[model samples]
Target: MKKKIISLFIILTCLFSSFPFILAAQNLKLVSNYALEDPRNLFYLDNNVYVADGTNGLKIVNVGDPNNPQDQGSYSVSGVCFDVFVAGDYAYLANGITGLQILDVSNPLLIDEMGSVVDSNYAWGVYVVDDYAYMADSDDGLEIIDVSDRENPVEVAESSSGGYAEDVFVLDGYAYLAEKSQGMRIVNVTTPTSPTSLGVFNDGSDIYGVFVEGDYAYLAAHGSGLIVVDISDKNSPSKVTNIAFDGMAREIFVENKIAYVAARSEGLILVNCTDLDTDLTVMAKLDDNSETGSGDAGVYVADNYAYVVDQEKNSLQVIDLTASGGGNIWLWILIPAILAVVVLIVRKSTAKKEPSRKEKLSDEEVEEESNEDGEESAVVGIEESESEKEEIELKSIPEEAEDSQEKSEESEQSE
Candidate 1:
C-alpha cells in the first residue's frame, strides 16, 4: 500500500512538472535566405532583420513574410559593424574600433548617421534602454553613453570588468556583462553614471553573448554551450545549469523562455528553457547542411521565425519554428490523464486479486476453515502414529522368531 502511494505521488508530480515544457515546446525549419557580405550579428524589430554585415556595414532585411525575405535598406560604416540595436526612429551600431555609430533609420531606403562616439577598444555589443546606451567594449569593459540626444550622444560613465566584455544585457536596473574568459559580471546600473559591480559568476567558460529575462540571464558560452545563470539575487549570482552542443555558441536570443543559439559550427540550435529545474532541452536544430549558411554567427527570433546570420556564407536565413509541430497542451494533459487512469485501473485490479487482511470474514466461513485445518492436522498425526506402530510390530516379530529358534535348540538338546 505504501509503495503504491509513493508510485502514484511520483507519477502525479511528473505529470504536473511537465506542464511548462508542454506549454513552451516548439521545432524549427529553414524557410528562406537572403544573401549578404560577411554578416556577423543581427537584431529583429517590427518584422525587420537589421544585420551587422561585418566590414560591409549594416543591411536591413524585411521578414514580414518568413517564407520570402526582401532587402529593405543598407547603411555603410567605416569600421566593422559587430552589433546593432534598433529603437524608435534610430539604429545604434557597435562598430568595432570605430566605436558607437547612431543612424537615423526613419526611412529604411535612405539611412543616415545621426551621431558617433569613438571607442578606445572594439565595441563588441550594444543595448539601449530609454535614453542610455550600454556597450560591451572588449578589453575596455562596459561603456555607458547618453543617447538621449541622438545628434550628440555623450559619454556618461564606465565600469571596468576583469576580462574582455563581449556582450551586455540590461534588465530591472542591473547590467549583465558576458566577459569572454572571465565568465559573467552583474552590475547595478540603476545609476547609469555610477555603475557598481554586484557579483561575478565564472566557471572558466568563455562567454560571448548574454540575454536576460525575468530573474535569469542566459549566456552563449562559446564552446560551453548555453548556460543559465540565477540572477534572482543580484548580490550573489550563481550558475544554474547548462546544455552542451558540438558548435561554438556565439549569440543567444530568448523569447518566451525559448533560447535560439547561433552555434557557429553546428548552425542554429533551439533550446526549451521553460523548465529550469530540469536539464535544458534541445527542441530543434538546423545544421549548416542547407543553404541557410555554413557558419552561423547570429540569431534573432520573432513571430515564430528565427533569423540567423551566417558569417561564413555571408547570408541571412529565416527559419520557420512552427513548421514542425509543437506539443499541444491538451495532448500533454490527456497523456498524463490516460496514464493515471490506466495506473489506477491496474492497481484496482491487482488489489481485487489480492484480498486485504483488514476485510472481515463471516463467522460461518471462519469456523469451516478452522475445522478443515484441524482435520488436515489430525490426518497427518494419525499417519505418523500408524507408521511408528508398524515399526514396533516388525521388531517384536524378529525377537519372537529368535526366541522360537532358541526353544527348538533347547528341546533338541533335552531329547
Candidate 2:
C-alpha cells in the first residue's frame, strides 16, 4: 500500500510538472564591469562600494557614474573574507581565518585595518552598533567587542547559543543572528557585556544568510529558499512568507523598497521587498551574457545603479536600474499571453484522438499473462502431488518394517 501511494504521488508530480519554465522578462541595460576576485560581500556608502574579495582582501570602487566604476584602491588582509558591512567610515569585515578586521575606509586610497579580534575561532560574519562590534564566529560564537576607539578594539562577550552563528544584524538594542542550521536568533544586546538570547526562529531550512529591516527578518535559507519572518513580536515570532528564487541564495540586502539578492552562480536578482505577501517580485536578473554582465556576493543599490560582486569572475558588475524602471515586473501580461498559447495548443491537441496511450495493449499480451499464470499453477500442483505420494510411501514402509521386526523376534524365540 505504501509503495502504491508513493508511486501514484510520483506519477502525479511528473504529469503536472510539464509547465513551461516561466521567467519574468525584463529589459536590462549594462552599465560597467571591472576586475576583482571572489567578491562575496559589497558595502555601499554614497558612491563608494567596498567589496570583500574572499582571498583578495577588500576592494574600494567609486560607482558614482554607475556605468564606469573605477577601483580606487584595495586593502590586503591576512585571511579570506565572507562579507563587508559599513556603518560609518569604518568597514567591518567578517574574515574567515583572521577573524573580524575593522578598516577605516574614510581614505579610500589609504585604507587601514584599525583593529581586529585575532583570538576569534573562524569568524563568518560581523556587525557594528555604536562603539561595539559583533563578530559571528563559528567556534567562538558571537564574539562581542568594544570598538569605541577605532585604533584599538577589545572583546567583551561571546554567545554560542548552542549553534553556529554566521551573520549578525543590529536593530534597536537587539541583535538578530543568522545561526546556520539552527535558524535565526534574536538577542538582547542592550548590555553589550551580557547579551541575552531573547527569541529564536528555526526556519527548518539551512539558514545561510539573513537581512533585516524595521520589524522583518529576511533569511537566505539554502534549500527551503528565501524566508521572510515578522520580527515585530519578539517572543512569538510568525513567518510572513518565503520567495523561492529556485536557486541557492548566498547573500541578500535591502534598501528602501528594493531588494538585491546574490543567488550564487544564478547571478544577481533584484526584487520588490515591500510586499511580502507576494513572492518578492523579481525586478531584474544579471547573468553571464555577451551583451549583459554578471556577478554575485553582496548586492547594493546606490544612485540608481546596482553594484554586484561577481565571485568567480572576480569582477564588479554595474547595472542600470533606470532602464528597467527600478525592476517593475509586467508578468501579469506575459503570464496571460503564455497561458493563452497553452490553452490554444491544448484545444488543438484535444480535437484529435487524445487517448492517453494506456489502452494500446494487444490481445496477445493478455493471452501471454494467462499462459504464464497457468504455468505457475501447474508447477505448484506438481509439487503438492509429489509431497502426498511421499507421505503414503512412508506410511506403508513403516508398517512393513514393524511387522518384519516382530516376525524375526518370534522365530528367534522358537529356535
Candidate 3:
C-alpha cells in the first residue's frame, strides 16, 4: 500500500506540472494577419500561407506575424480561381480552367509554376491526401489525380457521375467529395495509384463545399443547406443532421465546435455545428461592401479576424472578432446596425436585379426616333393623348457598320 501511494503521488505531480504546457498551446490568439484583394481561398502551409486571388492570380504571404503579415507576392495564373490547397513543398491551385496546378512554393519568397494538369474542365477545389489529389472538377466531375510526382501529375480516374463536384476533402486514405447533386462521396485512396468509390451520402441538394474532421464531415449544401455526416462506416456514410440557411452557401470551414461559412451575398455566416438537433446559431456575419449575387464567394477566419472574399466588390473585407468595446453598448447597437445594413443591401440588390433598359444601355446607344403611331400605342397604356404619344427605334451606327451588317447578313444566310 505504501509503494502504490508513492507511485500515485509521483504520477499526479508530473501530470499537474504538464498542465501549463497544454494551456499555453490552447491559449493561442489570432496572430497578425490581414486581408487583401479578391482573396478567394486560403491554405496554410507551414509558416507560409497561400491565397487564391480570383482574377488576380495566387498570392503567397509570410504569416511570420500572426497580426501584421508580409506579402510574399503572387504568381501569374490565368482564369478566375476559387480555392487552393498546399502539401509538401508544392501549392495546388484550382485554376478554374487550367485544372489543378502544382507550384514550387518550396521557397516562400519565390514561387514558380512548375506545371499542371488541366482537368477535363475547370476544377473548383483540390485536396491532396497521401499522394493522390482529389479535384472537384466543374462539369467534368470529380477527377482523381496522382501528385506523387510533383513534376508530373497524372489523372487516375474521374466521374462526372455526381452532380457538380464543387469541393473535396481527403483524410485517412479516403476522399470526401462535395458533389453538388449527389451530396458527398467517400472514395478510398488507400491505393494511391488507383482510388475507388467506397460510399456516398446524398445531401439531396447541391453541396458546394465539405470539410472532414474526426469521424464526421460538415458540408455547405447550396440549396438544401448545411449537412453533417457520420463517416465512421466508410461503406455506409449516414447523415447525422442538417441545418438549412436562408441564403446560398458557397463554402464551409470547421474549427472545433464552430463552423464558418461563406453564404454568398449574405456575407460570412458562422454556424454552430456542435448540436445536430438544434438550429445553427449565427455567431457573426461580416457584411460585404458590394451586394453581389448569392454565388459571390466564401470566407475564412484566422487569428481573431474574419477574412472574407467579396467577388462583387473584387476585394477582401476584413472584420475583427475582438471585444474591444469592453462594454455591452456594442451588443445593443449591433442588432439595429446589422438590420439597417441588411435592409440597404436588399434594397440595392433589388435595384440591380432589374435595371431599366436606359440604365443597362451604354453611352454609345443611339437616341431613338419617334414613330408617331407606335409612340401613341406605347403611351396609350398610360392613358395619354394620341398626339402626345410617340414610338422610337433605338439602334447604333458606326463607321464599321458595313462590316457588322455583312456579318449579320452572313448569319441570316446560314440560318
Candidate 4:
C-alpha cells in the first residue's frame, strides 16, 4: 500500500511539471503578406489594421481576410508618423516634430485631422487611456494631453525629469515610460494634469520600448536585448533578467508566455518566457532574409497571427501561430497519466472498503476463517504486491524517457 501511494504521487508530479514546456514549444508559420511603404508601427482594432506609415501618414488595411489583406484607405499627416493608438472613433498619432495629431478614423477612406498639439520635441510613442493621451516626447520626457475635446486637444501637464522618453505604457493609474539611456521610469498619473514620479530604474541601457503586463515590465533595450523588471513594488522596481539577442531589440509584444520581438537585423524573433524567474530562451526566429527588410520595426499578435512591420520590405507580414507541434505530445502524455492516477485511486479506495465487510463475522468465526482461509489471504496479498510492482515500473518509464531526451539534446548541442 505504501509503495503504491508513492508511485501515484510520482506520476502526479511529472504530469503537473510538464505544463511550462508544453506551452513553450509553439509552432508558427507565415500565413500571408501585404505590401506597404515604410510601415513603422501598427495597431489592430475590430478587423481593420491602422499602420503608422513613415512620412506617408496613417494607412488603413482591412484584415477581415488575412490571406488577402486589402488596402482600405490612408490619411496623410504633416510630420513623419511613428506610433498610433486608436480609441473609440479617433486615432491618435505620435507625429514626430508635429507632436500629437488626432484624426477622425470613424470613416476609413476620409480620415480627417480632428486636432493637433504641435510641440518642439519629437514624439516617438503615444498611449491613450480614458480621456487623456500620454506622449513620450524625445528628450522632453512625458507629455499629457487632454483629448476630452477632439477638435481642440490641449496639453495639461508635462514632465521633463526622465531624459529622452521613447515609449509609454499605462496600467491602473500609473504610467510606465521607456526612457532612452535612462532605462524605465514610473509616474503616478492618477491626476492627469499633475503627474508625479513614483520610481526610476536605470540599468545603463537605452530602452526603446516598454510593455506592462501584470506586475512585470518588459523593455526592449537597444543593444541590451530584452530586460524583464519586477514592478510588483511600484516604489522600487528591480531588474529580474536580461535576454540578449543577435540584433538590436526595438519593440516587443507578449502573449501567452510568448514574446514576439522586432529585432533590427534578425526580423521577428520569438522567445519563450514561460519561466521568467530564470533567463529567457529563444525558441524560433524569422530573420530579415526570410522577408525583404533588415529592419523589423513593430509586432502585434492577435487571434493566432503575428502582424509584423518590415520597413525595408515595405509591407505587413502575418505569421500563423496555430500549428501543432511538441505541445501536442505533452498533452497526449498528460491525459493518460491523469486518467491512470484517478483509476488507481478509485481501485485503492474500493479495496480498502472490501475488508470492512468481513468485520461483521464473530471472533470465533474470524479465527476459524483465518485458519481455513489462510491460502485465500496469501493469494490476495500476493496479487496486491504484484500490482504495486507494476505501478512502480510504470512510474519509471516517463522518467527514463525524459532522461534519454535530455541526453540526446545535450549531445546534439555539444556536437
Residue 300 local lDDT, model 2: 69
Q: List ranges where model 1 is wrong by over 4 Å.
A: 1-27, 290-294, 324-415
lDDT of 4 by residue, 1-415 (tens): 7787787677667666765444433445666789888788999898888999989999999888888899988998889999999998899999999999999999998778889999999999999999999999988899999999989999999887848998999999999998989889999999999998888889899898888889899898888888899999988999988788777788888877667889877788877676787778777777756332267889898876778888878889887564442343123224445678678775884476445646988899888888879989889999999999999999999999999999999999999
TM-score of each: 0.74, 0.68, 0.64, 0.73
lDDT of 2 by residue, 1-415 (tens): 5564566556446434432222323444566888886777777887888888888888888887776778788888889988787887889888897877888888889887788878647787888878898887876567888989877888888777778877778878888888888888888889999988777898577776778888898887765657888999887667888777656676787777556677766777766676687666666677653222233656766665667777667788887655544322333234455567555655554465645433465678767877988999999999999999999999999899999999999999999
RMSD after CA superposition, every candidate: 14.2, 21.9, 34.9, 24.7
Give candidate 3's error at residue 216 in angstroms.
1.7
lDDT of each: 0.84, 0.74, 0.69, 0.84
Which predicted model would earn the best TM-score? 1
- Ranked by lDDT, the better of candidates 3 and 4 is 4
Q: Which stretches of candidate 3 lie over 4 Å from their true place?
A: 1-38, 46-48, 63-69, 289-296, 325-415
Clash totals, every prediction: 0, 2, 11, 0
**Pairs in clash, predicted candidate 2:** 36-314, 37-314
Local accuracy of candidate 3 as per-residue lDDT tens digits, 296-381: 36656565455555566655444455434122212322344545755564454445346777676566552342355567777785
Model 1 TM: 0.74
Which candidate do you rate higher for lDDT, 2 or 4? 4
For model 4 the TM-score comes to 0.73
